[model samples]
Target: MLIDAHCHLDFPDFDADREAVIERARVAGVVRFVVPGTTRERWPTVLALGERDDVSVCLGLHPYFMETHRDADTEALARALDAHPDVVAVGECGIDARFAETLGAQWSLFDAQLRLAKERELPVVIHCVRANDQLAKRLRQLALPAGGLIHAFAGSPEQARKFLDLGFVVGLGGAATHERAKRLQRAVKSLPDDGYVLETDSPDMPLAGHRGERNEPARVAEVCRVVAALRGQAVERVAEASTTTATRLFGG
Candidate 1:
């Protein structure tokens, strides 16, 4: 069974047939899922989805959603984490330099989430973008005890190595599907299979051929094939390594 290391089943895109999407993923060798909450507004939705036996969930405010975040959201997330023991990880939260203004707020909230995760002894799920260097530096400063997942990792080999050294699992997904993504493909190929996990970032990041189309968990099989080809391993080998890695990282 494979693990969709990061996704948003709570998004409205799946509202009409979320169960069916999950069922299709299950049939396609995806036995476990890891969905990350984007904001306090969606914590309930994210946690609620994890009520199912098949899904494992994490909570955090996404950098991209900084505009929607209020200071109280941090307190609310803490309460939610305490109330829901099933919340296994701390984030899809981290710095996103892609937006300079919100970058400040994102770090403010991201640091708080990291502290909460450290306090709770739960792993983290990072949503780093154009800020891996700073993210790595801050994570080092905070010294998080419970490592995490760097979702949809599209960073340099050096960045991947940094996160892996910090006991993080480099999340691979549809972002690596593009033929012209030679750098990402090379990084994926070079990354140690033991420190890597598979994902689809479903309802987003559709593969090259499927660009402009909605991505789904079931389509992760195509991503698996892409990873397999990059690693020069059989698809089953990719699946086995990723599944084992996911089980170890999330204990699913």
Candidate 2:
């Protein structure tokens, strides 16, 4: 079985046939999913989804939606984590340099989440984009006891190693399947057996041949195939390694 280490199954895109989507993923050998909450307004839906035996949940404020988050949201997140012992991690949080205007605020929010994770001894599920170096620096200084997963990682092999060295794992997904993503593919090829996990980042990051359509957990099987080909390993091996790493980072 495989786990979609990161997927937004709570998004409205799947509201039409959510169960069908999950069934398809299970049929395709993707047995579990990690769903992360992006905002306070969405936490109810995110938490509700966690009721499933096959779904794990995480809560945090995403940098992309900085304008909607208030200063008290971090404290709210702490309470949410306390109230929900089933939450597997403390994230969907990290710095996204693409949003230049909210970069500073993003750092503050991300830092707060990191500290919360440390205090709770829970791992994190990060959403890094164009700020791998900066994020890595913060992670190193904090040295979270439970470590974390850098979801949908698209950095170089060297950068991947930095996270691994800091007791974290990089997540590989649809981005690594594109033929033009030579750099990311190289990073995938160089990853150590235990240094990476698989994710679909569903409702976004559609795979290569399915670019215009909505992505889903079912497609993570294709991601495994591509990653196996990239690393010159068997598909089953990639699936097992990634699932193992994901399970270790975010318990069932």
lDDT of each: 0.87, 0.93
Of the candidates shown, which would achieve the greatest lDDT relative to the real structure?
Answer: 2
Task: Give residue 166's lDDT in candidate 2 (0 to 100).
Answer: 94
Least well predicted 10-residue stretch by lDDT in candidate 2: 243-252
In candidate 1, position 148 carries an lDDT of: 85
TM-score of 1: 0.97
Which has the greatest TM-score? 2
Q: What is the lDDT of residue 113 in candidate 2?
A: 96
lDDT of 1 by residue, 136-159 (tens): 888888777878888888888888
